[model samples]
Target chain A: MRARLLEATVELLVEKGFSGTTTTLVSERAGVSRGAQLHHFPTKNDLVVAAVAHLTERRGEELAERAAELPTGSQRTRAVIQMLGDHFAGPVFTAALELWVAARTDAALLEAVAPLERVLGRETHVMTVELLGADESQPGVRELIQATLDLVRGLGLASTLGDDTRRRRKILDQWALTLDVALDKEKQ
Target chain B: MRARLLEATVELLVEKGFSGTTTTLVSERAGVSRGAQLHHFPTKNDLVVAAVAHLTERRGEELAERAAELPTGSQRTRAVIQMLGDHFAGPVFTAALELWVAARTDAALLEAVAPLERVLGRETHVMTVELLGADESQPGVRELIQATLDLVRGLGLASTLGDDTRRRRKILDQWALTLDVALDKEKQ
Candidate 1:
C-alpha cells in the first residue's frame, strides 16, 4: 500500500505538478483508501517529500542495475554516455524536475529535497567515473565527467519540450568521441 | 505600464512561480491600478504568456549586447562560453524555468510558450555558431556547438539548486578546451 501510494504520487507529480497533486488524487490513483492515505501521509508535503525520496532510491538502484551491464573497452565511454542520456530523459527525471522547480519557491520542499539531490548527484558522478574507468587524478578528466553529466542533463531538459532524440543522439555521440580523447579511453 | 506589468510578472514568476503569481500581485508590484492591469491582461494566462515573450526578446537583445562586447582571437571561445553560462544562470533563466516546469502540466501554456521557445532556441543556436566563429560546414562542428549550449544550460540547472559557480567554472573551462580542439580553432 505504501509503495502504491508513493508510485501514484510520482505519477501525479509528473502529470499535474506539485500544485495539482493532492492526497485525494494520489489515493484515487493508488486505489488506497483516503483514511489509509491520511494515516500514512498526514499532509501533501509529507506525501510528496516521501515520494521524492522513493524516486531517488529507485534512480540509484536503476543506475546500479544498468551499470552492472555496461560494456568494457573502447565502446565504454560512448555506452556510458548513452546510458546516462536515456536515464535523464526517462520518467524519473521529469518527475524530479517538477519537484525541483516547486522547491525553488517552497522552502520546506527545498530543505527536504536538497540533501538527497546532492547525494544522488555525487553518486552519479562517482559512478560515471567508475563506468568510464577514467582516472580523476588526471588533469581535465574530472571536469569531462562532470561535463558529460551536465550535457545529458541539458539534453534531458530539451526532451521535456519535445522529442529531441535525433539531435540528442548526435550531440551525445560527439561528446563520447571527445571524452575518448580527453580520457584516452581509446588507448585503454 | 505594460512594461512594468510584464516586468513584475517575470519577477514574481522567479520568486513565487506561476501558480503563486496573480494579476493582483503583478498590479501591486508594478504599482499599476487594477483597472489598468486588467485592461492590459484580462487573464493570468495572457499576462504570463506576454511576459514570457517579453522576456524572450530581452534575452535576445541581451545576447546581442553582450555578443558585441565579446573579445576576439584565442580567449573568444572561453569568453563566449562564459557569457552563455552567465546568461543561463541569471534571473531570466530562473523565470523561464518556472514556466517550463508549469507548462509541462499546462496544455494552454504549452500551446502559448512552445512557439516562442522554438524561435528563441533557433536564434540562440544561430548566435552560438556565429560567436564561436566555427565552420559548421565541417562535420561534427554543429554537434559541438549544440553540446556547448546543452552543457551551459545544464550548468544553469545545477546553479538553481545552490551556488555551483565554482564547479561550473571548472567544467566550462574544460569544455572550452575540448571545443577548441573539436572545432580546430587553435590551428586557425
Candidate 2:
C-alpha cells in the first residue's frame, strides 16, 4: 500500500507540480481510500516528503550501483559520470525540475528538497573524488571535475528547456574530451 | 489593459502552474473583462508566449545595459558574467524551469520555448564572443566561462532548496581566481 501510494505520488508530481499535487489526488490515483492515505501519511506534506525521500535515496543508490559494476579504471570513472547523467535524467529530472521550480517560493517544499540535494551532492562529490584521487593535486584536475559537474547540471537545464539536442550533445562530447585530456595530463 | 492582463498572467502563473493557470484565473486576477484578454491574446498560449517574450526581451536589454556600464578588462568580463547571472536568474529562472517541465508533454510549449531560448542563447553568446574575441582558443578560457555559468545555475538549483549564499559565493570567488589564471595564461 505504501509502495502503491509512492507510485501514485510520482505520477501526480510529473503531471501537475508539487503545489498542485495533493493527497486526495494521490489517493484517487492510487485507487485507495482517503483513510488509507491518512493511515500511511498523516499529512499531504508527509506523503510528498516521503515520496521525495524515497526517490532521492533510490536514485543515488542506483548510480552508485552502476558505478560499482564497472571495471576499476578510467572505465569506472566514465561509468560513474554516465551513471550521474542517467540517474538524475529525463523524466526523473523533470520531476526534480518541477519541484525545484516550486521550492523557490514554497518554504516547505524548499525544506523538503534540502536533504535530497545534499545526498545528491555527496554522491557526486564522493564519486568524483574516487575517480580523480590520483590526480588530486594536478593544477586543473580539481577545477575540471568541479566544472564538469557544472557542465552536466547546465546541460540538464538546457536539455529540459528545449535547447537543441544536437548542441547539447556537442557540448557533452566536448566536456568528455576535456575531462579525458585533463585526466590524461595528470598521468603524464 | 494588455499590461494589466500580463501582470495577472504572471500572478496566476506564480500561484498555479502552466496547467493550472487559466484565462478565467487571469481575468479574475486582473479584474479585466474576459473579452479584453481575448482582444489582446486570443488564447492562453498566446498570452503566455507574450509574457515570456516580454520578460526575455527585458532581460536582454538589461544585460546589454549592465555590460555597457562596467569598467574594461577583467572587471568587464566579471560584470558580463554577473549580467548573465542576473538575466536568466531568480524567480524568473523558476518560471523558466517550469517551461522546461511543461515542454516534455506539451508540444505547443516545446515549440514556444525554442525561439525564446534561442534569443536568450544568442544574447549571452554575443556578449561572451565580444569579451573573448581576441583569444577564445586559449585553453580553459571557454571552460572557465562555462564554469562560471554552471556555478551561477548551480546556485539557482542550490538556492531553490534553501539558503546557499555561502556555496554560491565560493563558486563565484573560484570563478574569479580561475578566470584570472586562465586569462593570464593566454597573455603569456
Candidate 3:
C-alpha cells in the first residue's frame, strides 16, 4: 500500500508538478484510503520526501543493472552516455525535476531532497568512473569524467522541454570520440 | 515603471519560484500601483513571459560585452568557460529556471517560452563559437562547441541546488585543455 502510494506520488509529480499535486489526488491515484495515507504521511512534505527517496533507490538499481551489461572500453563509454540519456529522458528525471523546482521555494523539501541528491550524484559519478575504468588519480581524467557527466546532464535538461534526442545523440557521439582521444593520451 | 516591474518579476521568480510569484508581490516590490501593473500585463503569464524575454535580451548583451574582452586563442576558450560559469550562476539562469518549471504544466507559458528558449540557445551557441573562433564548417569543431555549452548548462543546473563552484571550475579548466587538444588535431 505504501509502495503504491509512493508510485502514485511519483506519477503525479511527473505529470502535474509540485503545485498541481495534491494529497487527495495521490490517494485517488493509488487507490488507498485517505485515512491510511494521512496516518502514514502526516504532511505533504512527508509523502513527497518519502516518494523521492523511493524513486531514487529504484532508479539507482536500474542504473546499476544497466551498467553491469557494458564491457569496459570506448564502447562502454558510448553505452554509458546512451544509458544516461535514457535515464534523463525518463520518469525518474521528471519526478526529480519536480522535486528540484519545489525545493527552490520550500525549505523543508530542500532539506529533504539535498542529501538524497548528493547521494545520487556521488553514486552516479562513481558508476561512471567504474564503467569507464577511469583512473581518478590521473589529473585530467577525473575532470574529464566529470565533464561528461555535466554534459549529459545539460542535454537531459534540454530533453525536458522537448525531443532533442537526435541532437543529443550527435553530441554524445562527438563527446565519446573526444573522450577516446583523452583516454588514449593517458595511456601514452 | 515597466522595467521596474519586470525586474521585480525576475527577483520574485528566483526567490519565490513560479507558484509564489504573484502580481501583488511584483507590484509591491516594484513600487508600482496594482492598476498600472495590470495595465501592462493583465495576466501573470503575460507578466512572467515578458520578464523572461526581457531578461534574455539583456543577458545576451551582457554576454557579448564579456566575450569582446577576451583575446582570441586558448585563453579565449578558458575565459568563455569561466564567463559561462558566471552566467549560469547568476540571475539569468535563476529566472529561466523558474519559467522552465512553470512551463512544464502550463501550455500557454510553454508556447510563450519555447521560441524564446530556442532563440536563447542558438544565440548562446553562436556566441561560444565566435568566442572560441571555432570553425563550424569543420567536422568535429561545431559538435565540440555544443558539448561545451551542454556541459556548462549541466553544471548550471547543479549550481541551482547549492555551491558546486570549485568542482565546476575544475571541470571548465579540464574541458578547456581537452578542447585545445581537439582543436590541435583539427589543424593537423
Candidate 4:
C-alpha cells in the first residue's frame, strides 16, 4: 500500500505539482482507501519526503549499475554522468522538480530535501573520486565533479522546460566530451 | 494601469508561480480595481502572455547592458553566461518554469514560449561567437555554443532550485574555463 501510494504520489507530482496534488488524488490514484494513506504517511509532507528518499535511493542503484558496466577509469566517469542524465529523464526527477519549486517557500519540504541532496552529492563525489582513483584527492577534482553535477542538474531542469530533444542530446554529448578533455588536461 | 498590473504579475509569479497565481490576487496586489483588471486583460492567459513579453523585452535590454559593461573578450563571455544565470534567478525564469509546467498540458503556452527562448538562445550564440572571435559558420563553434547554452540554462535552473551560491559560482567559473579550453583546443 505504501509503495502504491509512493508511485501514485510521483504520478500526481509529475502532473499536478506539489501545491496542486492532494491526498484525495493520491488516494484515488493509488487505489487505496484514504484511511490507509493517512495511517502510513499521516501528512502530505511525509509522503513527499518519502518519495524524494525513494528517488535518490533509486539513483544510487542506477549509479551502481552504470558503474558495473564500465571496465575503464574514464568509462566509469562518463557512465556515472550518463546515469545521472538518464535518471533525470526518468520518473523520480520529474516529481522532484515540482517539490523543489514548492520548497522555495515550504519549510517542510526544504528541511526534508537537504539530506537527500547530501546523499546525491556524496554519491556523485564517490563516483567521480573512484574514477580519479590515484588522483582521488587532486586539487581540482572536487571542482570538476561539482561542475558536472551542477551542469547535469541544470540540464535536467531545462529538459523539462521545452521540446528540445535534439538540443538536449547535444548538450549531454558535449558535456561528456568536455569531461574527457578536462581529464586529458590532468594527464598533460 | 496595465504596467502596474504587469509589474505585480511578475512579482506574484516569482513568489507563487503560474498555477499558484490568480487574477484576484494580482488585482489586489497591484492596488487596481478588480473591474479594471478585466477591462485591461479580459483573460488570464492574455495577462500571462503580456507579462512574458514584458520579461523577454526587458531581458534583451538587460543582456545588451551587460555586454556593454564588459571591456574584455573573456569578461564579455562570462558576463553573458552570468546574465543567463541571473535571468534564471528571478521573474523571467519563474515565468518560464511556470510556463514549462503549464506547457506540459497547454499547447498555447508552448507556442507562446518558443520565440522567447529563441531570443535568449540567439543572444547567447551571438555573444559566444563575438567573445570567442569564432566563426559562427563553423560546425564546431556551433557545437561549443550549444553546449555552453545548455550549461547556462542548466545552471540557472539549478540555482533557481537553490543550489548553493558558492557552488553555483564555481560551476559558472568552470563553464567559462571549459569554454576557454575548448576554444584553445579548436585554435590548435
Candidate 5:
C-alpha cells in the first residue's frame, strides 16, 4: 500500500507538478484509503520526500548497472553521456525538477529535499568518476569530471521543454573528444 | 503601470513561483488596482509571459554589454563562464525556472513560454560565440561554444539549491583551459 502510494505520487508529480499533487489526488490515484495514506505519511512532505528518495535510489542503481557494462575509453564516455541524457529526460528528473521548483519557495520542502539532493549528487558524481576511470586526486581531473556532469544536467533541463536529443548528441560527442584530450594530457 | 506589474510579477515568481503569484498579489505589489491589472492583462498567462519576456530581453542586453567588455583570448572565455554562472543564479533565471516548471503541466503556459525560451537560448548562444571569438563556421567550434553554455547552465541549476560557486568556479577554470587547448588544436 505504501509503495503504491509512492508510485502514485511520482506519477502525479511528473504529470502535474507540486501544486497539483494533492493528498486527495494521490489517494485517489493509488486506490489507497485516505486513512492509510495518513498512516503511512502524516504530511505531504513526508510522502513526497520518501517518493523522491525511493525513485532516486532506484535510478542510481540502474545507472550503476549500465555504467558497469561499458568498455573503458572514449566509447564508454560517450555511452555515459547518453545514459545521463536519457536519465535527465525521464520521469525521475521530471519529478526532481518539480521538487526543486517547489522547494525554491517552500522552506519546509527545501529542508526535506536538500539532503536528498546532496546524496544523489554525491552518488552520481562518484559513479561518473568510476565509470570514466578518472584519477580524482590528479590536478584538474576531478573538476573536468564534474563539468561533464554539469553539462549533461543542463542539456537535460533544456530537453524537458523540447527535443534536444540531436543537439545533446552533438554536445556529448564534442565533450567526449575534449575529455579524451584532457585525460591524455593528465597522464603525461 | 504595465512595466510595474511586470516587475512585480517577476519578483513574485522568483519568491513564490507560479501558483503562488496570483493576480491579486501582483496588483498589490505593483501598487495597481485589481481593475487596472485586469485591464492590462486579461489572464494570468498574459501577465506572467510578458514578465518573463521583459526580463529575458533585459538580461540579454546586460549579457551583451558584459561580453563586449572582455579582452579577447582565454580571458574572455573565463569571463563569459563567470558571467553565465552569475546570470543563472540571478532573479531572472529564478523567474524563468518557475515558468518552466509551471509550463510543464500547463499546455497553455507551455505554448506561451516555449518561443521565449528559444529566443533567450539563441541570443545567449550567440553571445557566448562572440565572447569566445570563435569561428562559428567551423565544424566543432560552434559546438564547443554550446558545450560551454550547457556546462554553465548545469552549474547554475545546481547552485540554486546549494553554494556551488566554488566548484562552479573550478569547473569554469578547467573548461576554459580545455577550450583554449581545443581551439588551439583546431587552428593548427
Candidate 6:
C-alpha cells in the first residue's frame, strides 16, 4: 500500500505538477483507502517529501545497476554522458523538477528537499567519476564533470518544452569529444 | 495599470509560484482596481503569460545593453558566460520557470507559451553567438554554445536550491577554457 501510494504520487507529480497534486488524488490513483493514506502521511508535504525521496532512491539504485553494464575504453565517456542525459530527461527527473520549483518558494519543502538533493547530487558525481575512469586529482576535471552534469540537466530542461533529441544527441556527442580532450583520453 | 499589474504578476510568481498566484493578489499588489485587471486580462493564463513575455523582453533588452560593455579578447568568454549565468539565476528566470512547469501539464498554457518560448530561445542563441564572436561555420561550435547556455541554466537550477556561486564560478571558468579550445581561440 505504501509503495503503491508513493508510485501514484510520483505519477501525479509528473502529470499535474506539485501545485496540482493532492493527497486525495494520490490516494485515488493508488486505490488505497483514505484512512490508510492518512495513517501513513498526514499532510501533503509529508506525503510528497516521502514520495520524492523514495522515487529518487529507486532511480539512483537503478542508475547504479545500469552503471555496472557500461562499456569500457574509448566508448565509455560518450556512453556515460549519454546515460546521464537519458536519466535526467526521464520521468523521475521531471517529477523532481516540479518539486524543485515548488521547493524554491516553500520553506518547509525546501528544507526537506535540499539535503536529499545534495546527497543525490553527490552520488551522481561519484558515479560519473567511476564510470568515466576520471582522475579528479587533475586540474579542472571535477568542475568539468560537474559542468557535464549541468549541461545534461539543462538539456533535460529544454526537452521539457519540446522534443529536443536530435539536437541533444549532437550536443552530447560534442561534449563527449570535449570531455575526452579534458581528460586526455585517446579519441575513438 | 496594465504595466503595474504585469509587474506585480511577475513579483508574485517569483514569490508564490503559478498555482499560488492569482489575479486577486496581482491586483492587490499592483494597487489597481479589480475591474481594471479584468479589462486588461480576462483570465489567469492571459495575465501570467503576458507578464512573462513582458519581463522576458525587458530582460533581453537589458542583456543586449550589458553585452555592449563586455571586454574584447581573453576576458570576453568568461564574461559572457557569467552574464548569462546571472540572467538565468535572476528573478525573471524564476518567474518563467514557474510557468514552464505549469505549462507542461496545462495544454492551454503550453500552446500559448510554446511559440513565445521558441522565439525567446532563438534570440538568446543568436545573442550568445554574437557575444562570443563564435563562428558557427566551425563544426561543433554551435552545439558548444548551446551546451554553454544549458550549463549555465542548469547551474541556475542548482542555485534555486542554494547559493551555488563558488562552485558555479569554477565550473564557468572551466567551461570558458573548454569553449576556448573548441572555438580555437586564445587561452585566457
Off by over 4 Å in 1: none
User: Which is better, 2 or 4, measured by TM-score?
Assistant: 4
Instruction: Give the winner by TM-score.
Output: 6
Candidate 5 lDDT score at position B50? 99
CAPRI class assigned to model 3 = high
lDDT for every model?
0.88, 0.65, 0.86, 0.71, 0.85, 0.90
What DockQ number belongs to candidate 3? 0.83
Candidate 6 stretches greater than 4 Å from native: A186-188, B186-188
- Tens-digit per-residue lDDT, B152-176, candidate 2: 6655655545545554544445455
CA lDDT of A146 in candidate 1? 93
Which order, best to worst by TM-score?
Answer: 6, 1, 3, 5, 4, 2
> Ten residues in a row with the worst lDDT in model 6 chain A?
A179-188
User: What TM-score does candidate 3 get on C-alpha atoms?
Assistant: 0.96
Which stretches of candidate 2 lie above 4 Å from their native place? A15-34, A70-79, A134-147, A162-166, A176-185, B11-33, B134-151, B176-188
| Each candidate's clash count | 0, 0, 0, 1, 0, 0
Which residue pairs overlap in candidate 1's backbone?
Answer: none
Top-DockQ candidate index: 6
Estimate the TM-score for candidate 6.
0.97
Model 1: what is its DockQ? Answer: 0.84
lDDT tens digits by residue: candidate 1, A78-170: 788999999999888988888888888899989988987888889999988888888999899999999999988888988988856999999
Clashing pairs in 6: none
- Model 3: lDDT of residue B117: 91
TM-score of chain A for candidate 3? Answer: 0.93
**lDDT (10s digit) by residue, model 1, range B1-188:** 99999999999998898889988999999999999899999988889989988987888898899999998888899999999999889888888888887888899988887887888788889999999888999998999898888988888887988847899999999999888987888643
Give candidate 6's error at residue B56 in angstroms: 1.2
- Given candidate 3, what's the lDDT at residue B21? 96
What tens digits encode model 3's per-residue C-alpha lDDT throughout B1-188? 99999999999999999999999999999999999999999999999999988988898888888777876644767787899888988888988988987798889989998998988888888887877777889888888988888888888888889857898899899998899788663331
Model 1 per-residue lDDT at A149: 92
Tens-digit per-residue lDDT, A1-188, candidate 5: 98899999999999888999999999999999999999999999999999989888888888878877876643777777778778887899989988988887899999999988888888888887877778888889999988888888888788888846788888888888888788773332
